[model samples]
Target: MLKHILISVISNDKPGVVEAIAETVSDNGGNWLESSLSQLAGKFAGVIRVSVSPEQQEQLQSALSQLIEHGIWIKTEHIDADSAPKSDTTNAYIHALGPDRSGIVRELSRALAQHKINMAYLETALTSMPYSGDPLFDATGQLELPEGVDIPQLHDILDEIANNLALDLSLSETPFE
Candidate 1:
């Protein structure tokens, strides 16, 4: 039987950091599956999904723990079972952008929470506009709306928030692959 797990790593950024973590997983008979990694504020942060034989599960966990001595902090959660995508929900893609400022995420996330919307993943970044050189805030994420929530309802909520925050927001139902 195969065991699935999610591992989150945070450490000072440096060369060979990913290689070291990957090598440890390989040595422990773990198969790297999916990952989202990035360098932020001079640190390497990422979440990796991996699978291993049930027999090697403990060994893999132990090996991952030992990485802390090398300045790599890791937290692992063993998944009990694979989660099938939900059918009673509306999945959509969201893009939000505006001038870089504080409280954008808090406001938007708060609004989503108030409406019981589930955010699958959200990535935000600060970037400069090409010609203007002004700092801009960009966010992209996947949202799962409850069955009763329609696209128009979601758009209305997002539109209100965007107007208040002076953001350009877009939301579209995700076409199934």
Candidate 2:
């Protein structure tokens, strides 16, 4: 039998970091399934999902610890698919565009919180043009809505907030798979 493990790794940014981790898993006969890795503030951080046979679990942990001793911190957790929660919820994707300013995230998140929406992912980036003195910030967020909620009411609330914040906001319903 094979078991799934979710691993999170964090360490100083350097060459061959990913290679070293991948080699450790490959040497242990583990298959890497999914990962999201990025460099933030000069540090390398990542979350990876891998599968290994039950018999190889202990050896894999030992190998991971060895890597940690060499300066990379690793955390591993066993994921039981059967115990995962099921959701019959839907969601809407909200995209907002406006100049960089304070109170944008606060206002948007506050409104969503009041409606009991779950924010799954959020990304914001600020860009400045050479000729323009002001910077523009683009913000995108994915929000999960409860089943049987009125979307029109939600849109009205969002629009009201956006207008007050002087941002252009767009919302669309997306089915949760």
Which regions in candidate 2 have their CA more than 4 angstroms from the true location? 82-84, 174-177
The residue-level lDDT of candidate 1 at 158 comes to 89
User: Per-residue lDDT tens digits of candidate 1, residues 13-52?
Assistant: 9998899889999999999999999999999999999999
Best by TM-score: 1
**Model 1: how far residue 158 lies from native, Å:** 1.1
**What tens digits encode model 2's per-residue C-alpha lDDT throughout 1-177?**
788888899999999889988999999978998888988889999999889999998899789878977678999999974544477677678888877789889999998888878887777778773578688777887888877777899889988988887788888775222
- Please state the error at residue 51 of candidate 2 in Å: 1.8
The true-versus-predicted C-alpha distance at residue 98 of model 2, in Å, is 2.1
How much lDDT does candidate 1 score? 0.89
